[model samples]
Target: MAAEASPAPYADLGGENTGPVYTQSKGDTLAVRGYDVVSYFTGDGVPVEGSQEFTVRYEGYDYRFASKDNADAFVAEPAKYAPAYGGYCAWAIGANDALAPGDPNVYKIVDDKLYLNFSEDVATKWNADIPGFIASADVNYPTHAPDEHFQD
Candidate 1:
């Protein structure tokens, strides 16, 4: 017997891509990930006064919130505030000359750990080696900012 096929795409990124989630309700466009104005997370959730910013605590030190709401309202929007890519290191993807976005599904939730990765593809590649592309990019990314990893 053969295995059943999944209807979803291999690389969904939880949304259309690594941008944000939006919905057309009654012919109106609404930002799903809250009304913080910034498409930080996966998008298409709800809107809170200050739930638009983020502060990913990973790799030992606390990465300061990039936005005011992310830092102030994370407690209220934990899932809505965490980065999509597990926070492996966005700069690394930008450096590798690959445009990769974080994979919400390919995430690591540590009791006191900040999950991270290069890109969703790289994360898939990482399965081959626990510390695969991550270690590689750490060595070559500084020389190049490749935003081509997460191509639609």
Candidate 2:
């Protein structure tokens, strides 16, 4: 999904990472698997490529947006647009409470929050117990970083 980051358009954003928990698989790269975090909420939940024309660097990682408006919206409220569990797989967060890279294409929006999973199979399991799993994820998320453990 157009995940490359461009340095020029991000001066407006205070160059920072989204959060301590945000996933930067392979050590360094763009956030949210390179998908536009705002699109999951505003659009049909389908992963969309973010354009370099509209980008921001929050916390430390860079995020791309499909348009200036979307980028502005994200800049206004980063926590609202950022994914839960450090953009790790929601199902993994709930189940194993361990770290796994969430597939941008496989996601669900619950309570206006964007949730992602490692795969379609895992997402199915997560969908079945949204409330229960979220409870687990909520409790387990803060203590550890998704990348701390090698296991998925």
lDDT string for model 1 (1-152, tens) is 99985332211123122332212222222222123322234245332333212433222112233355444454444455444332334434434534343433344333322234445675555556545444564454444321222322
lDDT of candidate 2 over 7-66, digit per residue (tens) = 675435564442334455466647775678998878566679898777677666667888
lDDT of each: 0.36, 0.76
RMSD of candidate 1 to the truth, in angstroms, is 14.9
Q: Ten-residue segment with the worst summed lDDT in candidate 2?
A: 16-25
Candidate 1 backbone clash number? 25
Give the clash count for model 2. Answer: 7
Superposition error at 26 for model 2 (Å):
3.1
- Per-residue lDDT value at 132 in model 1: 46
Q: Which residue pairs show collisions in model 2?
A: 16-58, 16-59, 16-60, 17-58, 17-59, 17-60, 17-61
